[model samples]
Target: MIGMGSSRTQRPHTDRRDWDNLKSVLPFLLDFRSRAIFALSCLVLSKVATVGVPVMLKGIVDALEHKPEQVVVLPIALLLGYGLLRLLSAAFNELRDVVFARVRYRAMRRLSLRVLEHLHTQSLRFHLERKIGAISRDLERGTRSVSSLMNFMTFSIIPIMVEFLLVGIILLKEYPPIFALITFGTIAVYVWFTLRMADWRMDDRHTMNTLDSQANNQAIDSLVNYETVKYFNNEHLELARYDKTLNEWEGYAVKSQTSMSLLNFGQSAIIAVGVTIIMWVAANDVLQGQMSLGSLVMVNAFMLQLFIPLNSLGMIYRSLKYTLADMDTVFRLLDQQPEIQDLPHAPALKVAKGEIRFEQVEFGYQADRQILHGLTLTIPAGKTVAVVGQSGAGKSTLARLLYRFYDVTGGAIFIDGQDIRAVTQESLRRAIGIVPQDTVLFNETLRFNLQYGKPDATQADLEQAARMAHIAEFIAKLPDGWDTVVGERGLKLSGGEKQRVAIARAILKQPPILIFDEATSSLDSTTERAIQRTLEEVAGDHTTLIIAHRLSTIVNADQIVVLDAGRVVEQGTHPALLALKGHYAALWELQQREEQH
Candidate 1:
C-alpha cells in the first residue's frame, strides 16, 4: 500500500528564506523571453535618453550665455534638443510598460494557476486543516506581489540604478572628485538608513498581516456558519472576535505609518544636505570663473533628476520586500508534497470485473489514533455489499481510502486483483462514483452542478438521471427549473433535495463501481424508500458498496458487513446476520425499537 505519512508546516518568511522564493518566479518572467528582451531594451534606451536631457539643458544654458546677437540663434537648436530628449525619455518609458504588460500580467496568471493546481493536488488532510479565508488572502496577496515585485524591480529599482550610474559617470568625468564623493556618499548613507529603518518596520507590517488574516478568517468562518451563529444569538461575539484582531492590526498600522514619516524625514535631510553642499561649491566655482553658469545649471538639473527617484527609494524598497514576503507564502504552498501519489510508471486501472477487495487494511488520520484496523472485506463483481456501523467505526474512511483521498497506511486495497497504489489515481477514481454523506454544491445553477458529473452528457441523459434520482419533479416545480441557483454548499435546497442532486450526479457518472455513503440519510421515510428503490435500479450490474445508518435500507443487499471500532465483527447475508444474534442483530433490534416508537 502507498505510505500515508507526510507532514509539513509553513514557516515565517525572512530575508534568508525569500531568496529561493524570488528565484522561483524567474521561470514565469522568462516564459515570454522576446517581450522581456524588448522591455529591457526600452529600459536602457530610456535611461540613456534621460541622461542626455540634462546634457542638452546644459548646452541650451551655455548657448544662451553667448554674445547677445548670437544668443537667439544659438540657443534655439539646444532648446529644441532638450525638449526632444525629454519627450524621447518619456516615450521610451511608456513603450517599455506597454511591451512588458503581457509579461507581468501573464506571470501573475500562470503563477496563480500553478498555486491553484498545487492546492488541488494537496491531500484531503491538508485542506481539512487549512482556513479558507486565510489561504485565499495569501493567494490574492501572493499573485499580486508577483506583479508588484516585477514592477519595482523593472521600473523603479533598475531605472534608479541606471540613472545613478549615468550621473556618477558625468560627475566623475566632467567635474572634480569632491562632487562625485559628496553625491555618492549621500546616496550610500540614504540607502543604508532606509534599509535599516525598513528592516525595523518589517515587524509592524508582518504583525499587521497576521492580524489582518486573523480578522478575515474569523469573519469568513462566522459567515460560513451564519446559521449556527444566529441560532446561538452570538452576533456580538463574532463582532468582538473580529474587532479584537482589527484593534491589534490598527496598532501596528499606526506604528508603521508613523515610522514611515520618520524615515522620509531622514532621507530628505540627507538629500538636502548633499544638494546644499553641491550648490554651494558650484556657485563658488562660477563666481571664481573656474566653471561656467551652464555647469551650475547642469549640476542642479542632474541633482533634481537623481533625487526624484531617490526620494521614492524607501517606499519602493519596502514594497519590494513586502512583495517578496507574500511570494514566499505562495512558494511554500507549492513546496507541499502530496501524501498520495501513483507509483512510478503506474498504468491505468482497467475495471474489467470491478471487483473491490480491502485486504487487512490499517489506516488513520493521525499515527496515534488509528481509525481503520486490519479491516478486510470485498464486493464481488456486479454485486452489492452494505457496511453498517455506529459513528467512529471508520465507515466513511472506507470511501476515503477507496477514492485515494488518503492512502492506506498498511496492507493493500485492490480492484480486479490489481493493487490500487500501482495504478494512476486519475484512472482509479474515474472507474468509481460516490455520493458522499455530506453533499456540497457549487454556488451556481442546478444545471451546472448536475452536469459536473458528466460534462459532455446529453440533455436527455441529464433528465433521465434526475428523474431516476427523484429530483426532476422538484426541479421542474421551481420557477427557474434547472437554471435555479444553489446557494453556498447548496444551502438554498433542503437536505433531501441536495442528497437527491448528489444521487443524480453519481448516476450520471455511470462508473463501474459505486459508493453510496449514507446517500439517503437526509430524506424522510417515504422519500427514502422511493430513492432507495431508484438506487437499487441504478446499482444493477455495477459493484456497489453502501454505507448506511438505517438497517431497513440495506435489507436486500447480497451481503451485510457489521463494523465496530474499525474491525469487521461479522459478514453474511442480511437475514442470515439477523438470525446470527450477534452484534449486527443487536444493533438491528435497537434501531427497530427506535423506529417503532
Candidate 2:
C-alpha cells in the first residue's frame, strides 16, 4: 500500500530504552498523585516496623540473658513491643495496598481508554492493515502491565530497598566494619547477577511474545473465515499452522523456565555463602569475648530480614523487564499519527442545499496506481444521479472520496460550493449516509444496529424506516423480532437481510445527502425491485448518489453517467444514453441479455 502522507517515526518496541518507556506511564499515575504519595508513605512505615521487629527481638533476647531466672519471667515489655511491631508491619502493608489500589487500577482503565480512542482517530488504512488478534493481545498485555509495574514498584521493590537501607545502617553502626562489608558486598554481587540474567532472559521473553501473537492471530483469522475453511476442508492445515508457532513458543518458554531456575539457584548460593561467612565471623567474635550472644542474635536476625526479599529479586527483576516491554508496545500505538486530519479549528459542514460536486477529482490508494483520474461530476440539489461501470472503474472510489475516507490527490470535492477539506470530518460525515455494497453489521441486537445511525431515535422512527426498507415484515416474523442478535459481521442473517438492515439504518439517519453504493445488489429480484422503489421514494427530495452495476435499477435516475478507465465516457438521461449507443448502451444491452437468461 502507498503511504498517503508523511510516514510516522513511531514503531513498536525495538530498542532497550526502558527508562523512556517507563516515563510514558507518568501521565496516568499523576492523576492520583496524592494517593500514590500516601501509598509510598505507608510502604516506608511498613518497612520501618518490619526492621524494628528484629531490634525488638534482640532486646528481648538480651533482657533474658541478663538473668537465667528471668527465663521463667518473660520480658513482658519487650515481648509486647515485638508483637506490636509485627502487627504494625502487617497493618501498614495492607494499608498500602488499599490506598494504591485505585491508583494502579485507574491507570490501567485510563490507559486502555486512551489507546482505544487513539485507534479510532487513525485513518481507515491503518485499521485495514492491522492484525486484529495481535492488536488485541497487545492491548490486553499492555493494560495489565501497568498494574504489574505499579504493584512490583510500590509493594515489592520500594519496601525491599527501605529494608535494605535500615539493615545497612544498623550493621554499620552496631557491628564491626567487616560485617557491613560482607553484607553490602554480597548484595552488590546478587544484584549484578540478577540484572545480568534478566537481560539474557529478555530475548526469550521477546521471542515468546512474537510467536504467541502470531499463533493467536492465525487462530482468530481462521475462526473468522470459518465458512471458507470448512468449504476447503483446511482444518488440519490451520491446525498445523497454529501448531508451528506454538511449538516454537513452547521451546522458548521451556528455555526461559530452565534459565530462571538456574538464576534462582545462583541467587540462593550467593545468599547462603554470605550468611555463613557473617555467622562464622560473629561466632568467632562471641567466642573471643568481643561480642555478646545478643549481638550475635541481632546479626542473624538482620541477615534473615535482608535474605527474604533478596531471594525473590531475580524473578521480580525479570517480570519488571517483561512488563516494561509490554508497556512500550502500547505507548508506540499512542504515538501513531493519523493520516487524515482536519484543519486546525475547522468548522462544521453546513448542508444548505446538499448539492455535491466532484470537481476534476483525482485519487489512488497507491502512488503509482491511480483509481480515479480527473473525474468531474455533479448531483444537483434535491436530485438523484446514478454512476454505472464495470468492475474496477472507480465506482466505489467516488463514494470513499466523497466520504473523505481519503483525501483527493489532485482536485477538490465540494458540497454547496464549500471545499470538503475545509469542513470538520465528523460534521461532514453526519450530513451523509451511505449503505455500502458489503453491508457488515455489528454483532448486536437488530434494534441496536438500526439505532446506531441515530442513537436517540424513537421507536416510531425505527418502525417507519424498517418498513420503508421492506425489512419490517421479515423482522416481525422472527421469533425474537427486533431484539434478535446479529452474529459476528451479521453472518447469522442472509446477505439480503443484511442489505435491508443497512438500508433501514441509512434511512433512520435521514441525512440530506444519501449514498447507496450497490445497495440493492444483494437482494433477490423481487426484493431488489421493492427496495429500489422504496429507495427512489426516500431519495425523492434528497441529494442522492447511486453507484449501480445493474442498468435496469437506475433507469429512472435524473442522469446516468458511465465510467470507463477512471473517466466519464458518457453521461445523459437513460433514453439519451441509449440513443448515443456508447458505453452505457453497451452495458445496458449486456445486463439485459444476462437478465433474460
lDDT per residue as tens, model 2, 341-386: 9999999999999999999999999999999999999999999999
Clashing pairs in 1: none
Clashing pairs in 2: none
Number of clashing pairs per prediction, in order:
0, 0
After superposition, the stretches of candidate 1 with alpha carbons farther than 4 Å from their true spots are 1-16
Q: Please name the candidate that would achieve the greatest TM-score relative to the true structure.
A: 1
Q: Given candidate 2, what's the lDDT at residue 6?
A: 34
lDDT score of model 2? Answer: 0.90
TM-score of each: 0.97, 0.96
lDDT of 2 at 558: 95
- How far off is residue 378 in model 2, in Å? 1.6
